[model samples]
Target: MLIAQITDLHVSFDPAFLDGRVAPLEAVLRAVAVLAALDPRPDAVLLTGDLAENGSAEEYAFIRHALGELDLPVFAVPGNHDSSPAMRTGLGSFMRASEASHACYVVDDFPLSLVGLDTSVAGKAHGALDPARLEWLEKVLGQRAGRPVFMFMHHPPFDTGIRTMDACGLLEGRERLAELIAWHGGVVGVVCGHVHRSIHTSVAGVPTVVAPSCAHQIALELRANAPLQYRLEPPAIALHRCEQGQMMVSHVRYIPDFPGPWRF
Candidate 1:
């Protein structure tokens, strides 16, 4: 199975976002176009998080309409810039009913179980997996005992060494989450967004990845106490492919109209 991951769209009704530096809406549309044109289209599209810039209904509505062009199942989780309630209501068609109050749910229709975890904290930049949320995840993982589960969420549990981003990273329940994944032993991979750059690591011995933003990217600054800033870099998406007996493999596909395909 193949899955396409897009993240940090930050779609806003306002065309001039970030002081007119980038157009989040257009950026997402471009990403969508690329996904639509893929030769062998992905089985599903995972909207990791930050689907909107203001968490507004209008923004979500626009995104819904924009994504309607693709004939693929789209799964989404909430990010810091998103309002869970607003997203749930606006993108109801794309999301399934969750037993937990948070926007956490499991998709069982695919070969790989797709688990979406909610890490967005309302009105806060940081993310956390509180006891209740952790409990819900544990229950879900327990139920899917032997299935190869692929988890996706907004914030990454591990530190990226980018001090500013790490300061607001998954601040709670990471250790427990790691333990749960280790205990399950069926989790194939964990995918995340919100760092606005492609990063990879292992959590509980499972490969974990953070997809780059579709609009703007966080500047690669690792200096201590560096200020948080964004750059209008070429947007990108992540493609994850998994086969029966092989581990998942990931590739980063940049979304830009650059020259390519010339004979090497």
Candidate 2:
């Protein structure tokens, strides 16, 4: 099955339309336009949060508008910019009752098993996966034993080499996640967002990926000592193709003419 990963929209009610130089509301809208035009389309759209620039109901409404055109099931988790209750009230309508009603859920089906983990903690710039979430993850992993499961969250369960962003990934409780991945042979890969850059690595010998922002990207400079740099580089989204009993492969595509107009 095909799965699309859209991360870090960072949507905001930009009362002042500052073009691409400011928060990328238009960039996100452009991304969705491209997503809607995909040839075969995705079975599901898995968003790894930062759905809003601030945890505001209006911003969630903005996200709702952009995501509304897609003809697919959308699954999301809370990022630092998302409000748990608000996200529940907004996106919960598309989710199943068994989805736990907290903007976190799992889809174990024909082509793949997706585990949506919520790593957002209230009023914090960083993220964490605590005991309760970990235990829930363990239970889901247990239920899907022997099946190829693809896990997703807003924060990488481990570091991403960039010091500043690394500090923001799962904190002390990461060991539990690592141990679980180490033990579970069915986990084919881990997909996460929040760093706003694409990273491919292996954690616990399992392939893990960080989906870049749909709105903007963090400078790849591994240090803040350098000149401040954030760019309007082409916005990107990830596509994962999964076939049972085979490893999943991902393609990160940049939507061109984004935040602009182009005719076919």
Question: Which model scores highest in lDDT?
Answer: 1
Candidate with top TM-score is 1
lDDT for position 122 in model 1: 83
Cα lDDT tens digits for candidate 2, 183-261: 7788877888988888898788887899888877777866654443466666799998877766678899887874422
Model 2 clash pairs are none
Off by over 4 Å in 1: 258-264
- Which residue window of length 10 is worst by lDDT in model 1? 255-264
Each model's C-alpha lDDT? Answer: 0.88, 0.77
Lowest-sum lDDT 10-residue window in model 2:
93-102
CA-only RMSD, every prediction: 3.9, 3.9
lDDT tens digits, residue span 1-264, model 1: 999999999998775677767778778889999999997999999998899999999999988888878978998999999998899899877777885468888999999899999998888999999998999999999999988999999999999999999988999999999999999998888999999999999999988999999888898889998888877767899999877766678899999862222211
